[model samples]
Target: MAKVSISLDAELVVEVMVLAGVGSPQDAIEAVVRDYIARGHRTEARTELKDEALRELDAKPQEPQG
Candidate 1:
C-alpha cells in the first residue's frame, strides 16, 4: 500500500489513539482509515437500495379516488 503524511491537531491525535487502542497516532489513523473504507462500502450499498426504492416509487402509476 502507498503511504501519505497528514498533520492533525495534538488533541485530536490523542483522542484517536485512545479510541483506536493503538500505540501511536499514525497507527490510530491507519485503523480509522481502514474502518472508514470498509464502512463506506455499506454506506454505498444503502444509498443504492434507497435510490432503487425511489425509482420504483416513481415508476408506479397513481390511482384515482373520489
Candidate 2:
C-alpha cells in the first residue's frame, strides 16, 4: 500500500493507541479507520436488505377477510 504523511495531536494519537490496544500511532489510526469502513459497509448491506423486503411486501396482493 502507498504511504502518506499527516500530522495529528499527540494526545489524540495516544488516546487512539490506548483504545485500540496498539503500541504504535500508525497501527492505532489504521485499525480505527479500517473498523469505521467495515461498519459502514455492513450498515449499507443491512439497509439494502430491509428495503428489498419492503418492496417485496408492497408488491404482494392482500387477501380479503370475512
Candidate 3:
C-alpha cells in the first residue's frame, strides 16, 4: 500500500470520522472512499439495467387488439 501525506481541513476530518464511524483518520477516509465507489458502481449498474430493459421493450413484438 502507498502512503500519502496531505493536509485536510480539521473539521472535515472530524466529520469524516463521525460519519464513517471509524476511530482513526485513515480508516475514516478509507471507509468514505469505499462507500463512494460502491455507490457509483450501484448507480452504473442501475443505469445499465434500465437501458437493457428499454432495449428489450423496444425489441418486443406488439399485438393488435380486436
Q: For residue 45, give model 2's deviation from the true position in Å.
A: 0.9
Model 2: CA > 4 A from native: 62-66
Error of 1 at 31 (Å): 1.2
C-alpha displacement of 10 in model 2, angstroms?
0.9
Model 2 agreement with the true structure over 1-66: per-residue lDDT tens digits:
889999999999999999999999999999999999999999999999999999999999989879
lDDT of 1 at 63: 97
Which residue pairs show backbone clashes in model 2? none
Residue pairs clashing, model 3: none
Candidate with the greatest lDDT versus the true structure: 2
- Which lDDT values do the candidates have, in the order given? 0.92, 0.98, 0.92
Residue 35 in model 1: lDDT = 97
As a whole number from 0 to 100, the lDDT of residue 42 in candidate 3 is 100
lDDT of 2 at 23: 100
lDDT of 1: 0.92
lDDT of 1 at 3: 77
